[model samples]
Target: MTAGFFEAPRAAEFALRNVRVPATLAPGAVAPATQDGHLDVDIAIASGRIADIVPAGTIDVARGPDLRRSVVWPTFADVHTHLDKGHIWPRAANPDGTFFGALTTVMADRQANWNAADIEARFDFALRCAYAHGVSAVRTHLDSFSPQAEISWPVFAKLRDRWEGRIALQASSILAMDPFATGEGDRLADLVARHGGQLGCVTRLAGEDHVGVPANFDDYMTRVFELAEARGLDLDLHVDESGDPEARTMIRIARMAAKRKFKGAILMGHCCSLAVQPDEAIEATLAACAEARIDVVSLPMCNMYLQGREGGRTPRWRGVTLLHEMKARGMRVAVAGDNVRDPFYAYGDHDMLETFVQAVRILQLDHPMGDWPQAATTTPADIMKLPATGRIARGNPADLIVMRARSHSELLSRRQSDRVVLRDGMAIDTTLPDYRELDAIVGMK
Candidate 1:
């Protein structure tokens, strides 16, 4: 009930009675029914760290207790998102729904009103939305190509420092071409490093006029990587975001990282090219990615909206990366809400549950390993390298969301709502919203 109760590294205890969990914690497995259709589990939180999890009935509920009865799971972590562009904008709709059109809209709107106050307000609203939806950690992209990085990057840093107890923040310096040229590479990297941010690049910059300088894709990427290494920062590149079959930038980056022995810190987002690549190429690329330990983050919602409609075909491209194949190859794959309600994506409620549902349906992961929801929820946590979060086990972070659905199929089929959300063993919002509304939105019964 107190604000400090949920802060990190504080020892608080909680009990959840009558909860069902999946049978296996492996990649993809069906969550089994509870033996008694109820579980009495006790969660111990200390110093904002999950200290222990014990049988609920083992502890006496009468003595100084923080307890609740509902399904509990780890807090969600979004490995990729553009937090600075979280607000909705009024602009010419993309009739063609092409990636280029979306990019143009974003560019126009960003140029129109991208300032420190505007960017901070949007990011603050986004962080609040993420917290209300039970997302405790996120890696957000800040467009460094815009001179606004001088304003936005500091806002993100301040927010991260202020909310360290509630969220873990990672700022990605977006190296995509904007108002800046390739000549600004060293300065940009220095700027990001000055603010404790990481390096990010977009392999393909959209536009024609900038083609001579910053438009040089190969040179830009090489410079970004070189600067990243020089600054001792990690890389998260938007490699081949379009559906172009010829875009093999991710493959090249993978090979380069492997050759340089890059320590598995790079994340390649929206490698949509991999979805359409030849089988041999896909295999080789996956192998190289695994060898280099490159992390792959697929943005289903944005990619589905922007790139899938190309060529005007029925049963449009799913716009999802080779998630299953990548998993099989032992590559770390995390799915994120890349853009939320912005020019690039007209939708995104900042709820990762929706993202999980899309993954299940688009990836046909109903029977992944054995359980669908568990895999859908847990895999992303592992991919994001979140050790204290994601699984329902002893000593894990007490950040959890309790859903109304009884089974994985029920949860997925209904897109069930989180009935209760707890951060650090204390409930924040206990009101259980209707999942039926979401079901209707997704065309589910």
Candidate 2:
């Protein structure tokens, strides 16, 4: 709490009464936020779930925490993240800041120091950043390029237990689908099952430029589906992350998933190529996604960091998925914090609201107030399969955040970092990661 926040007279009002919260920030909301008027409501929590919603001044609030003219909203959930490779940007720095450069630098660093201890430290740092910024859940894409997952899995499972009910931690294997031939594919699926994580893949069905058709593409995806079907695990893929218009693997995957009627939830991250496709093609792809019940995870931060640099000339299109079209088609789309201060994206604090702001700007997702907040809240929580998450209704879990900003515009500004995070009605004392001195480790690189 900030200084002078706990005035003795208004101690009761500070918690649940006299708070002018925006009426719109909730799951499945699409209404524009009206600036002139705010709602006065008192929220009551009991046993971790919302006990009641009464008019302000009606509820007894002698025990309310000091909100300091803050707005209360559902805590955020990051649908996509790369945790195993997080917080190593200095050691994984690439002068060019290109996508390929990130891969090269991070792979080299990982092969050197990505043991259980190192990975756990970096992962802990990233999670702390998330917790401090009102994120209660995250789906991290673990580094699964090798058998290292067998080692990393135990560490993540332990943290999942450690942060239980506070921050729901879900993980997936981010690996190439081509290695199924070497029998490593089975091992990866088994690893995910053993840890109860999702099966993930970076589906590279196209070449570097990715403007032309891919050879033996379906064969690769067949193996991916086979593994998912065998293990009954959900599928999350890195699909069509390239900027090329012809990198249309997202469409193919959607059609295939719909046809196969895959049982588990299917999620796709970074459908950046869909932006360049023709309107007809894009609409068809979105329709297929809707039919397959696929959740499109838009990662504005990493895509903005990596895309359009190699084109030399000022790039015409930003690296982003078609959020407007997808939303118009009634498809499920949520924004996420993809990579946090890793080789892929060199800027982040594991703040999902930061990602929400980036998506609002880069994707021009000027969705009405209630709708935009849902991207980070209810929508992603549903995609994460978190049952009691992402809403502030009666009987919903009291996983919430109180920020020093009251208006929707103030929320987007992201200027207020002083806030209280609550899980099941208890305040959390959060710590931030320090990253000041990296000269000895990263200066030489």
Candidate 3:
């Protein structure tokens, strides 16, 4: 009916009447049962928690805005992202839009300008975008190489405190595996533990391109596992992001996880090569992942941008992991917005709704639609270990995204840019930060 269809009342208790929510996201009983995988209910909010749910028209509509069967979703959780490297595209544009270009350009950019202040400014900006778009939790990978680790982790900790209630933040240290083989790995792991962060590294050695898995892959992976085990830290890694079929470290990491019985959780991002591997190989890897209890977050946006690019040829094959197969095997698979406005992705506003819409198209996550939306919401939240987030169940916080779209068709066909983001039963200001705000820092002049 309007640009922003729903507005919560100023009163503490209110009702959202005639709203439709995915049945999977809405837990507990209601007067009217779910139909076609969705539930049409009136949700009651008391003191910022979901108080009750009943069939639409069963509740008085005067308490709050009548949503007219609009689709409601819980606030999102982005489990894989690069906040420390976000919004640096102006000064550090990828030279050729290749993986190599992104890697080298970001390296130079980090070296030249990644002081605490610079990182804090950009990191806070990204968080603001995410919060406004209804993301309640995020796990960002910080570029943690030597001095950068010393610098970025502190900024992340500070931001974690600053954005506490509005947006839950988690950080992971990311660099090449070579550092993990040396003493520097121990130091970084210690820093991560100090900041309550995850220990992470790319599954490749230093100076190695995205070809085959590095020859020392096992040795370095062993070192990384040992470091995490010693510190009692979880692992979040950038694994096999390359389209090169030879870049098959994801399976190895999974196998190693099963062999070592690493105590903490493991979340591996971007396993792009798995899509290109033979079906048997793909199944085997996924089996290993399931056996190891490894959680996978596919960065579809960034993978599509970087995976199959060449200078003067039409690229083929979407660079995404075998999500359908993995899901069939009962593995926890999530889709996330990774590297927003950075060299690896080039574009994104830290918006999870957009990420889900694009993922639906990029990975063909539709046809049946089913519970696939969970990949961007409940599933990622589960992976991030934030159980309280990403679902609209009774007794949970009334953190929700109320959109004009009532069905999956309308939800996917158009971008819900004007969706209302409610945090604790109050609508937050969804205004995105202006890019000009970083003109000076990013050298946009």
Candidate 4:
């Protein structure tokens, strides 16, 4: 447990007066202002709404002096994370440092070291780090295979109530697709429906894994889709997350969604296999996903850690999906720091900026500050379809992040971590638990 970017944040002044931001330019914008149509806009937000947004030095009446240099933008959305299994490296260490190791260790730890309070403490701390880092929403995948959902759902309910206007927390079930074919599906669906959660399963379309993937394969997804249709819930699947070239579960899922005309949103994360697939296969899947209106989340952190480790030769792949290609096909793709300080990923603090930074490097988005904002900030939030959390506009809620960097380039180059996160137009304190103390809990000695 190391305190880096994930530590809790101190309080900030409650109000931002006349902070300057780019009117036309924004992070993750499809393109910069056409014909240099840029405006240095001074915005004032209050009561959870943009009170005013006028060109800088153009207010009709006398305004207060502008002093702070910052860029105002939407707070981020970590679309994919493992809250139930996060911050448990000390309690359970993965000696193999592989995907299988992560799966087995997480399963064992959930049975042994995990309970209500311990899970709540770790998950709450992760949320604090995200909030302080200017994240307004996070969608975490809970370990729903066991009865832990009974414990986890209630804990999240309490935390959601506590963090209510400041942060929007979304939950998804993480289990194999088969069990959903039986009574477990019905019970989980009831909990999910009651709590407004999604129906999720880890699907590995082609082959099988003893852990972390579905052995029932594409057939079981029928029950999953039927259950989602029955309950009016969205589907979130960990699809094609392996290094195997033939693991094309995502394509199958997309095709099925189209075949059945699945009602709710379909979000597929990981998709590591797509990168290594044949061009024909890639194109076919992309077309299907685009036609199906599916959203894809690229998890760079854990994939980088767990993929391509079994080879005797140098690791040729980066353990991520095709970002540029997906965008080319008009797929709604995003990036998230998946598992932090868990067996899946040894490092990460749930900081969206950190994830965005790594995404910039991995996806080669440094040029023109490519659509990084759209993917990291707005895309996932819109997927949740929540209010006051999607876009930055006059009528939208004042859920935004004002960064220390003065411009987009400077923001990326300097990475000024100092930020003021406003939830419904007011100040709030941040969260980060001490990793060293956690080591003692996990028996560091």
lDDT of 3 at 342: 84
Taken over the whole model, the C-alpha lDDT of each candidate is 0.66, 0.74, 0.88, 0.73
Q: Considering lDDT, which of the candidate structures 2 and 3 is the better prediction for this target? A: 3
Give per-model TM-scores.
Answer: 0.82, 0.90, 0.97, 0.88
The lDDT ranking, best first, is: 3, 2, 4, 1
Select the stronger candidate by TM-score from 3 and 4: 3
Show the lowest summed lDDT stretch of 10 residues, model 2: 4-13
Candidate 1: segments with Cα more than 4 A from true spot: 1-12, 23-70, 91-95, 177-182, 206-217, 310-315, 369-385, 430-445
- What local lDDT score does residue 437 receive in model 1, on the 0 to 100 scale? 28
Per-candidate clash tally: 23, 0, 0, 5
Worst 10 residues of 3 by lDDT: 1-10
Clashing pairs in 3: none
lDDT of 2 by residue, 165-192 (tens): 6689999988765676558889888989
User: How far does residue 441 in candidate 3 sit from its true spot (Å)?
Assistant: 0.5
Tens-digit lDDT track for model 4 on 1-445? 2222222122221234345454432322222232222235555555567665655544432333353445677777888998777788877888788888887888888888778888877888788778777788888888786587888888878888888766788888888666676798899988988888888988842224523335556668888888899989998888877788878778778888999998899998898988888899899989999999999999887888788877455667888899888888887888988999889998899888888878877777655655556778778877878644656666677676766666666667765555656676654454345666465446566
Candidate 3 residue runs with Cα over 4 Å from true position: 1-3, 29-36
Best by lDDT: 3
The order by descending TM-score is 3, 2, 4, 1
Best-performing candidate as measured by TM-score:
3
Colliding residue pairs in candidate 2: none
Which whole-number lDDT from 0 to 100 does residue 215 have in model 4?
Answer: 57
